[model samples]
Target: MIDKQEQSLNVKMYINGEWRESSNIQKRSIINPANGSIIGYSEEATIEDAREAIKAAREAFDSGVWSNLSTGERAEFLFKIADKIIENREELARLETLDNGKPYREAEADVDDAAACFRYYAGLITKPSGQTYDVPAPIQAMVIREPIGVCGLIVPWNYPLLMGVWKIAPALAAGNTIVFKPSEVTPVTSKKLLEIFEEVELPKGVANMVLGAGSIVGNEIVENKDVDKISFTGGTVTGKHIMRTAADTVKKVSLELGGKSPNIIFADADFETAVDYALFGIYAGSGQICAAGSRILVEESIHDRFVEKFVDRANQIIVGPGSDLESEMGPLVSEEHLNKVLSYIELGKKEGAALAAGGSRLTENGLDKGYFVAPTVFVDVRQDMRIVREEIFGPVAVIQKFKNEQEAIKLANDSEYGLAGGVFTQDGAKGLRVVKKLRAGITWVNTYHFTFNEAPWGGYKQSGFGRGLGTFGLEEFQEVKQININLEVEPIGWFK
Candidate 1:
C-alpha cells in the first residue's frame, strides 16, 4: 500500500523540541531488513549535536521546566503524550514496519505497548511516596525520592520506539529530562514519534531525539558529564561498554541486556499449548528477540514425541515478506544477522545434532529476494556446543533432553545468561518449584516471552541491572534523600 511518496521520505533529528537538520550532515539509508530495500533515510548526528542535546536536557532539568512540575502536572503531560501516541499509532506502526521490517501486526502491538508504557508511568508519577519517620529523643526523620537528573536514553534497533518510551517515560515521570537516541538502523520510527509531541505541548528540550551510530552520538551521550543518568537497552557486549563509559562520569546507570532463555518441557505439559508458545518464542521475530527461547529443554520421555509434533507444527508456518499479513516468519533483520544465524545452523550440523525439519535459509517460494531464514529446529543438542551455549538471535531452536528435575534445573541454569526462561507443565506446584530454583530473572510457566506492564522485567548477573515496566521501574529513576526534622518545638536547654 505504501507508494513512492512514502518510500522517498527524509527523517530529521529532533532536538530541544524543534526539528533540526544535522549540522555535521551525513545521511544514512535506512533499509527494510525483510526486503533489503531502502525504506527511509535519516541525517546522522555528530558529537556537536550530542553536546547540544546534553546541554538542552541539562538546561531543562536545572531550569525546572520539566523536573519542577507538580506530579499531577507531569502526570497530565504523560497522559497527553499517550493520547498523542494513540493518534499517531497507525503512522508510527507504518514507520516501524518500514524501518525495522517487522510485520504490521507485530509492530502495531509494539506501538500499543509504547502507549501503555507511558500510561503506566503516568499513573506512577503521583505515587512515589515520601515517608515520614518517627524517632524518639525529640527527633523526627523523613525520606524523599527525587529524580536522578538529565537522562541519556539509548535504545536498540530491534524495538526502537517501544524501548524509547520505556526508558524515557519513567525518567520523565520521576521528573527528569531526557535526550533519547534511537539506533541508526531504525531511527525514523522514533523520529516520527517525536512529531506526536508537537501538539502535546511538552516543554522544549524536555524530550529530545538524536540520531547516529552508537560509536559516535551514542558514545557522546554516555561519556558526557552533563548527562546524569544513562538508561541503555542493547547487547551485553555494548552494555558493558556503556557501563565502563558511564563510570567515568559516575552517572546513574540502568541496563537491559541480551538473553538466551531456556524453554523447558516437562512430561506433564500440554504439548499443544507448549508447542504453540514455543514457536512464538523462537520464531516470532525471526528469532531476533533478546528473550527468544533459543534453548529448549525437553524431558527424555517426551523428547522424541515433542520434536515430531513441533516440526510438523513449525512446517505449517508461512515464511515471506513481513508486509504479508499471512506470513508467520520473516527474514532476520539484516544480511549480517542472517549469516550469523546460518553459521549457528551449520554449527549444529557439524556438531552432530539431528536436524528435524529446517536447517538452512529458504529460497523456494516466490520470495527469493528477501533476507529470509526458514524456521529451524535442531534435536539432540548438547549444552557445550556454540549453538547451545551462545545467544543465537535467530529462528533456530535447539532441543536438548533432560532426565530428571535436577538435570532440568541444571541445564536451564547452565548458561552464562540469567535473563529469562520458560517451564511448561500442567502441575503449577511443580512448575513453580522448578522455576524458583532456576536462575533467570523472568520465568514463565506454561509460557515463554510474553511480558506484561504490571510485572518488573530485567535479568540477573551479566544479563544486566535494573527492571522495566512497573513500580520497581520507578525506583530506577530516583535517588533516596532522607530529611531530619526536630518535632520537639520546645527548645532544648543546651541548644538554647
Candidate 2:
C-alpha cells in the first residue's frame, strides 16, 4: 500500500534529459483516484515549457546526435529501458495502481507488457528496412524508410505507462526525437519512465516529457511548426480537434481514439466462456479501455441466460482501492469521470433500458471517499440511446439481443467507431465470418482484450487512423523515399 510518506516525492518534467520545474514553477496535486488523496505533485507545464521540450527535440533531430545512430545502437537503449522497467516493476506497478486506480495485478500486467513493448521494438528495428522494386531492368528503383522528426506523443490516462510506451518504443526505434506528454491527471509513471531513460543514458533531447494540461502544453505540441508528426491516443472529440489543429501545418497525425466495441455471443457459443469474457471485457480496467466491449450482443435464444449470468458475476466483483490484495476491481480514475459514467447510466434508464444490476456508486466497503462505481449492466437498451451510442468509459455494460448473425453484425457495425470487437461461437467458420464483417480493426474469435505487441493495433472510422504496434507501428514513425537510378543514360534529341 502507498502511504502518505510517498507524497514527499515531487514529480518534475523531463526536458532535454534534465529533470526540472515548469518555467512558472507551477504544480498540480496528483490524486489517488482510489481514495481522493494527494499522492504527490507534478509540474504544471506552460506553453513556454512545451516549446522548450519541442525545441530540444527539434534540435536533437536536426543535429542527428541520436537519430544518426545505427539501428543496433538505438536498440541498446530500448533494451536497457525494458530491463530497468522489469527491475523496478514492483514500484512502477504500485505507482500505476495508486495513480490510475486500477487493481495491482492489472497494473503489474501492464508494466510487464510495457517492458515487452520496448523489447519487441528493439528486436524489430534491426530487421531489414526498405524495399527494391522490380521495375524495368537497370532502372534501379527502390524505396527506403527514414524516421520522421520531432514527434509529439500524447497518451490518455487510462493506460498511462503502457500507451505512452506504445508510442515511445516505436518512435525511438525509428530514430525520431520526441516530446511526450502524459495526461495531466496521471503523470506518475511517465515521470518514472523519464528517470529510466536518464538511467539508460538516452541522449539528451532524444525524449522529453512535459507534464501539463492538454489545453496549453498539448496545444503547443500540436500547433508548433517544428514537430513533424503527432501520435495521440484519447477521446474522439480531442482527436478531431487534433486533426483540425495539425492541419494548419499539414503535419502527419496518427490517432487511436475512442470506441464502444461489441462482444457478440451466439447461442451456439460455449455459454460459460461467453459469459465470462463478457464480464472480463467490460469490468476489467473498470471499463476505462478505449477498446472495452461495453456492448454485449447476445443471440435472442440465449440473451436472458447470458444476462443473468453476467449480472451475477458483475455483482460479485470486489470494488476497492487497488492497494487491497483481494480487490478484483478499483475505482474510476477520477470523480469527474465517475460522474460522467453515472450520468450515462441515468440516461440509459430514462431512455427505457432496464437496469439489470449495479448502477450507482459504491459507498460501502471502505470505498466512500473513492471514485468507485459498481459494475453496472443495462438490458433492453435501444441502439439510439445515448448510453448505447456514446462512450461511457466506465464499468458499465449494456446488453442487446440479436435474433441471428445478420442482426448481430448490424448492431455491432452500427456504431461510428470501429476500434475493436469480439465474437464467440463453437462454429469456427461462423466466428471468422462474423469477425471479418465486424468493421473493426482488431477482433477476436474467442477472446476479448487480448493484445500483442507484434500485432497491428488501431481502428476504422471514428476510432481514428493509422496503426500502432508491429511493423506497421514502426512504419508510422517513418517516411518512405523512392530512389531511381538511370543505368543507361542515352540522350535522344528530338530537336535538330
TM-score versus the correct structure, for each prediction? 0.96, 0.98
**Per-residue accuracy of model 1 over 284-347 as CA lDDT, tens digit each:** 8788888889888999999888989999988888887667777777677777778888888888
Candidate 2 root-mean-square deviation in Å: 1.3
* Weakest ten-residue segment in model 2 by summed lDDT: 1-10
Single out the weakest 10-residue window by summed lDDT for candidate 1: 1-10
Whole-structure CA lDDT of model 1: 0.85
Error of 1 at 273 (Å): 1.1
At residue 253, candidate 2 shows an lDDT of 99
**Cα lDDT, all candidates:** 0.85, 0.93
lDDT of 2 at 3: 37
C-alpha positional error of residue 299 in candidate 1 after TM-score superposition, expressed in Å: 0.5
**Deviation in angstroms for 243 in model 2?**
0.6
